[model samples]
Target: MTADHKIHKKDPHYQQAKRERYRARSAYKLLEIQKKFEIFKRAFYILDLGCAPGSWLQVSKKFAEDNLTKYKDQYYHRDHYVILGVDIKKVSKIENVQFLQNDFTKPEFHTHLESYFQTKIDLILSDASINKTGNNFSDHLRQINLCLKILELAEAHLKFKGSLVMKIFQGADFKKMFEKAKSVFRILKAFKPQSSKKTSNEIYLVGLQKK
Candidate 1:
């Protein structure tokens, strides 16, 4: 095998210390966004759509633990935090988090939600992506449809002043989706995480302060 060929096969983040510690390159994406947005502060209930192998779930658990620790002295009573993660694929295993394997586009998905929390969710996250057929237009359409369905479910579960963070591609009806999201949430932002490959079109849309 050529040395140049071997170089192309290496996973850049796999050799990095942080990736080894966290077990995922996607973990850095959440860390970076949380650093600036403070998305985890005082968060009580969070819903993770398409959470498999759970990098965001890990970050969220840490946040809840910190919140409990930080307020123990002042509040005298600890608040309970509920975290639920759902994906079409089964999640390996995670502590202090509920994992469900089901298609989010179906009605049964809502049943999973009803079975879990009685109250509204504070944050909703979806890194869900459709299997691409390599046709850009078709891929974008499928992804956009998935994103819209996620938004519908998110809107139903999210509490007043809650937030949603989702992955979207810049194509087809991306602009229209953004505008639609803005109508329901006070703030809308599009962010491309550093962990994402330069050649990829994945962009995270954050809808904050739900109305």
Candidate 2:
């Protein structure tokens, strides 16, 4: 292996992801969430915002594959399931996923999303984060803003019973964000996957069955 690969392999999650053919170590985070909540139980159309390096897309595909028998009766009539990813930066191709390279903060991006799906989505996952500037407070505020944007998109595009999982830094604005999530979703939860680095303040907010 090359030196870079050697270094990456030393990380347990990275090694496991390599062995499992996942795109990145972060795949395990979504997998853990699935294990705890069964978020993909009946999902047919899914979206991944800020999916770069595409690990979450990999996890979504794997979940669909593994649960095919269970969800087939509910979704099999569809000619094809939709798994779309959007990011500001280009992502390497992954089979069965359509990716759009666009900044999601722009209003026009919603048009692209609606045109592609042509229907409300069943699940939306966002692991988007602002570049950390070493100032925790500023970083937290930026991430909170990003989470609110994701919530706006979800409100506009998610089906009534659909779900969302998004990452946000836990700081001053977290409770406000959580309350906003509660207003939009019948069930709201905060989760931190074991795969997440212990030192990181990032937590996932899950909103289920949008109101």
Candidate 3:
């Protein structure tokens, strides 16, 4: 392994995550986003796509429960909050979280979501990406496709004025993906958290107040 890779294996965030019993070190990324954007504010109903090992779900559940008694917002239909996680792989059970073992990029899955929530989502989180192939350009394009798929799902299920946070690889098509996201959200931002490795190309796209 390279020196940077070896250092990352011993990073403080990873150590903290293990000590806290979080599902993975990725939890810190979401915590940083929440600190910067307050995306969880008054957000009760949450959808976590590609949530395997359930790190994001763990964070979402914490925020959702906190929003339960937030005096209710006038612009949204959030009389209650539910957290649902979908991935092809199964995650160990987390209290109050429902896990679906199915591909979320399918019409059937979308249909199931409509029935399951019966209302719009307050926030959507996606840390999903294509498995890397070690070819930077190829991996970037693949991740861009996955982001497009996630954008479509967000459009269908997210509530009016809902928020979305998703990870994307920075590369040739990043600007194109960011612009596409702009068309869907009134406020769009590209944020990089300190917890991420310096060498990684990953950055998160935060879309707020979906239009």
Top of the candidates by lDDT: 3
Pick out the ten consecutive residues of candidate 3 with the lowest summed lDDT: 70-79
Local distance difference test, candidate 3: 0.91
Q: Write the per-residue lDDT of candidate 2 for residues 13-130, one digit (tens) a residue.
A: 9889889988889999998888887888777689999999999998898776655555446444344578999998999999888999999999898999889999999899998889
Tens-digit lDDT track of model 1 for 32-104: 7777677776677889888887888888888877877776565433577889888878887787888888887
Error of 1 at 162 (Å): 0.6
* TM-score (all chains, Cα) for each model: 0.89, 0.92, 0.92
* Model 3, C-alpha of 167: deviation from truth (Å): 0.6
TM-score of 3: 0.92
lDDT of each candidate versus the true structure: 0.81, 0.89, 0.91
Task: List candidate 2 segments past 4 Å from native.
Answer: 1-10, 66-68, 72-77
* C-alpha RMSD in Å of predicted model 3 compared with the true structure: 2.5
